[model samples]
Target: MTILVSGKNGQLGHCLVDRLNFSDLDYISLDKKEMDITKYDETARIIGEIKPRVIINTAAYTDVEKSEIDKKDAILANESGPENLSKICKKIDTPLIHISTDYVFDGRSEIPYKPEDDVNPKSFYGMSKLAGEQRIQENCDSYMIIRTSWLFSEYGKNFLKTMLKISKQKKTIDVICDQIGCPTYAGHLADAILKPIKKISENNFDSGIYHYAGDQECSWFEFTNEIFFVANNLGYIEKIPNLNKILAKDFQAKAKRPNYSVLDSSKFCKAFGVNPSNWKESLPDVIKSAVLA
Candidate 1:
């Protein structure tokens, strides 16, 4: 059976491709240039020709701040794109594995969010992603929506790389401490995603929303501190920058982020027999790659 992975240029897409390369799985990974999901004709044509048994959609407009002003682009990529893919998957009788965000929640809850928790997105980017999730559920009979948080990887632009890059140039930096969430490693998330794909291919698929993220939860400040400490020990960085913790309100961002958006992956762990991503354990590899790049 073949798997079609969208967003080959993305962090998650790159990690997915890395895993797929090591495996014996037959798959095709595409970026927007090759398959613009917002274009129904193009998406349908590509998927129809490939005829993949499973479709993993990692393509999304991820800029939270830009989404507020670029509503058209955000909706086209995050909402319309998923809507198109869902319809195509439904028509072709292919199962869809979609990646979602923790931003779907308003971040009012103190406890980690479950798959069945109420969703009230506070940002346009989150709203767009939520719209995509709803579309997939409405249009596709066989689909798994995995809601992940604070994704970082060796590939692409992400928090881990940003921290590493800025630390080298700046003596100090300020990070918001008010917001709290898990920092998931894309490599681990890619592996978590594949476990379900195997189940789906084996006809033991259980469809619905599932939360998968790092096992440890921390504020952005704490995450940054850990990154610096890890990178320093790994000799990737010569010095650790002074990290200042500030409230979210003090930060000038166009988007309103959740104060708390930690996800509960117990459901996913029980179903897939996989543990939540150990982001700290995988930090060394990510740091090494970022430093080398």
Candidate 2:
């Protein structure tokens, strides 16, 4: 049986494909064009035909601000899409490994969020993602919901890439400092997910929500600072932009973000014996790749 991966064009999907290419695993990766999860009949048709042993879903409506304006699209992609996948996975008796976000929490807690923590999402994007998690739990028996935060990589549109682009055009950049979360490297997250695919496929592992992110927590300003620092050290950037620290309240965004959304990954680490990504150590290579790209 093959391992099916969705969102093939996404950063996480790209990373997963890279790892799967070298491994002795038989897998098929599909982008939205091949299999749009939001369409039930289409998704069911494709998945039923493939009959994969395991399905990894990385597709999501991730634009926080855009979600506010395009509520229908966000709900369809984030909630209905997962609902369709869960129902199909259950029908085929295939295990699902779905990616989630830490935005499900309201960020009122001073400590890191646990898998079992109560969720009170403050934004439509967060609410839709939370709804997706619920749909999977209700529809599928064998599923793993991995909630991560602050994803950055050389590929795709993310904070690190945005900062890199802005540094070239502007000498000063203002970033929100009040909000804090772990910075996850997409490549590392893909590795962490792939490590347990065998066990999940064999029904040897537990199925539930898990947290996986960077070990360190920092504000967006700090993350940008580190990005520039790494880029400068690697000679990727001619000059580091002057990063101004601004509070979340001061930032005029359509969506409200959590003040602190750090996730506690002890459960995942203990279960998989894989530590969270060390984004600081991984930043240099990511910057190097982004520069060369």
lDDT for model 1, please: 0.93
Give candidate 1 misplaced runs (Cα > 4 Å): none
Ten residues in sequence with the least summed lDDT for candidate 1: 195-204
Model 2 scores a TM of 0.99
Residue 201 CA displacement from its true place in model 1, Å: 3.1
Give the CA lDDT, 0 to 100, for residue 76 in model 2.
97
Model 2: runs farther than 4 Å from truth? none
lDDT of 1 by residue, 1-293 (tens): 99999999999999999999999899999999999999999889999999999999999999899999999999999999999999999898888999999999999999999999999999999999999999999999889999999999988889999988899799989999999999999999999999778777555777899999999999999999899999999888888888888999999999999999999999999998999999999998888887787
Q: Which tens-of-lDDT digit does each residue in 1-293 have in candidate 2?
A: 59999999999999999999999999999999999999999999999889899999999999999999999999999999999999999998999999999999999999999999999999999999999999999999999999999998888899999999999999889999999999999999999999988999987889899999999999999999999998888888889988889999999999999999999999998999899999999998898887777
Error of 1 at 162 (Å): 0.7
